[model samples]
Target: MLSWKPFALSVAVLLILFPFVYLVLLSLSSEWRFPDLLPSYFGLKNWATILGSEAGLLESFVSSLLISLSVAIVSTTSGFLISRAVFYHPKKNTLTLLAYFPYILAPVVFAACLSFFFLKMGLFGNITGVIVAQFIIAFPYALLFFSSFWNKKIKSYEDLVATLGGNRWQTFIKVLFPLAKGLILICFFQTFLISWFEYGLTSIIGIGKVQTLTIKVFLFIKEANYYYGALSCCLLIFPPVVLLYLNKRYVFKKLV
Candidate 1:
């Protein structure tokens, strides 16, 4: 008898991967028109354009990397440190609940609300503005994420450190940091992703001037340039894929 289980599993795998497979195929082809089973031209020419100034993809990729890295580093570090304070505060729950405020509004609306201040502060249409905007969103998420990391056990660890004559700085360096190393890395990865794929906030705050990769992808799609869109999409997923692999291979392993 034929095993339908194997067939079903294969079909599921193909369905899940079809979009990514088609995206890669699309990136490699050009002038693919209706009723054509394949593109008119298929080669590395599309990929090669990334290196040229015409596509502007390489620039967008670099800009996105810098902005995401900046947001992730600052948000994750600040979130981790401040989350500890929130955990110990008398109004801990209220403060933590306020962390959800940024998420309550949609990104576009939030960006719109902050637009006037960003313009006045000269943050509009700049990389720093985008980073700051994204940080506003990512920081609260990081705060909420680490909030659960500060339970009674962790407080006990702090108390233990203090009983041993260790100061706050030493306790953080020697104890808390090492204990939360995996969580911090995971938070960094999460916050990086939050900033990486952000479009609405970036679009509004950047004022169409700061072209991050996500912005570039939307622009290409808006322009009906699917070839470039697919190409940009390829660049878009690369970093997160690498980060996922690293997290799985090293971070998750240690975490387990």
Candidate 2:
């Protein structure tokens, strides 16, 4: 028998890493003429320039992080409540199915459909508006993701807590949270990535006022600044990578 696991893993690694390698190479190259496999020269000057600037990469990176974090926390927390509500309802199946409608739709189309309301509310072009728009995309998926945890076994645990005189707060704090903790963390990170990489809704709702890292990457590309675009990509990859490492080392281990 032939073992293909190692070969598959190697291929997967290459597929994932090749783009990052190309981006790094492009970012570092001062000049590379045609037909060259590698750049003529490489330097950290681009990164230094991006970091030292007052109102460019650094500001955009911070703005992106703030908005993404806010969207993640708000979407996950609210979606949890919404999922619970639907879970206990008589029409749970129907409602749960309906919850996925937004998630399935293209984000640009969804945002465009709601553009008028945003304009009327004076939310268009505002950071709050961008957050709200992203939440619209993120919350539905979180709700659906969380709905899986509200199964019969979990319900029995809830019932047990209630039978023991645990009120709503006590029930959630002691029983519900403990069982749902891992799933909640997963939902948070999923929605975090959703908001972190979201550009369509943000561009539509924020009207280009809110310049996130995704937007910065596009803008840099538009200006033919591959180095800055790669820099933004690197910055965008940082938080999620760090979170994934921390989650693996701590949160997932704790869950196990």
Candidate 3:
């Protein structure tokens, strides 16, 4: 008797992978117009543009990496430390609630609200401005995420560290940091993703001057350039995929 289980599993796998497969195919091809069963051309030609100055994709990719890395590192470290302070604060709940304020507004609205300050500070339409804007959004998320990492048990660890003649910095370096290492890495990964794919805040704050890979992808799409858009997408997905693999291999294993 023929069983349908294998067939169903294969179909499910193909369904899940179809979009990514199609995207790669699209990125490698051009002139795929209507009524044509396939693209008129296909090869490394589109991918090759990344090395040339014509695409500016290589620059965009580097800019995105730098911004995302900065935002992730700052947000994760600050959030972890600040969340500890909040845990010990009298109005911990209130402070924690305030962290959610960023999420209350839509990204575009939030950008608009922040524009006046950015303009005043001379942060308008530049890389620094974009980084600051993305940091604002990513920071609160990290803060909230680390909130759960602080509890009575963690407090006990701090108390124990103090009892052992450990200073505040010593406690963090020798104990707290090691204990929270997994969470920190995970937070970094999450925050990195947040900044990596951010569009609305980047668009408004950057004013199209700071063109990150996400911005490049949008520009390509807006101009009705699907081939380049797909290529940009392929570039955009690369870092997160590498991060995910590292997390799975190193972070998640340690976690488990």
Each model's backbone clash number:
0, 0, 0
The ten-residue window of minimal lDDT in model 2 covers 46-55
lDDT of each: 0.94, 0.86, 0.92
Candidates' TM-scores? 0.97, 0.91, 0.96
Arrange candidates by lDDT, highest first: which order?
1, 3, 2
Q: 180-209, model 1: which lDDT tens digit per residue?
A: 999999999999999999999999999889
lDDT per residue, candidate 2, 69-97, as tens digits?
A: 99999999999878998988899999988
Candidate order (TM-score):
1, 3, 2
Displacement of the residue 10 alpha carbon in candidate 2, Å: 3.6
- Find the candidate with the highest lDDT and give its number: 1
* Stretches of candidate 2 exceeding 4 Å from the true structure: 1-12
Candidate 2 vs 3: which has more TM-score: 3
lDDT winner, 1 or 2: 1
The candidate that achieves the highest TM-score relative to the unseen native structure: 1
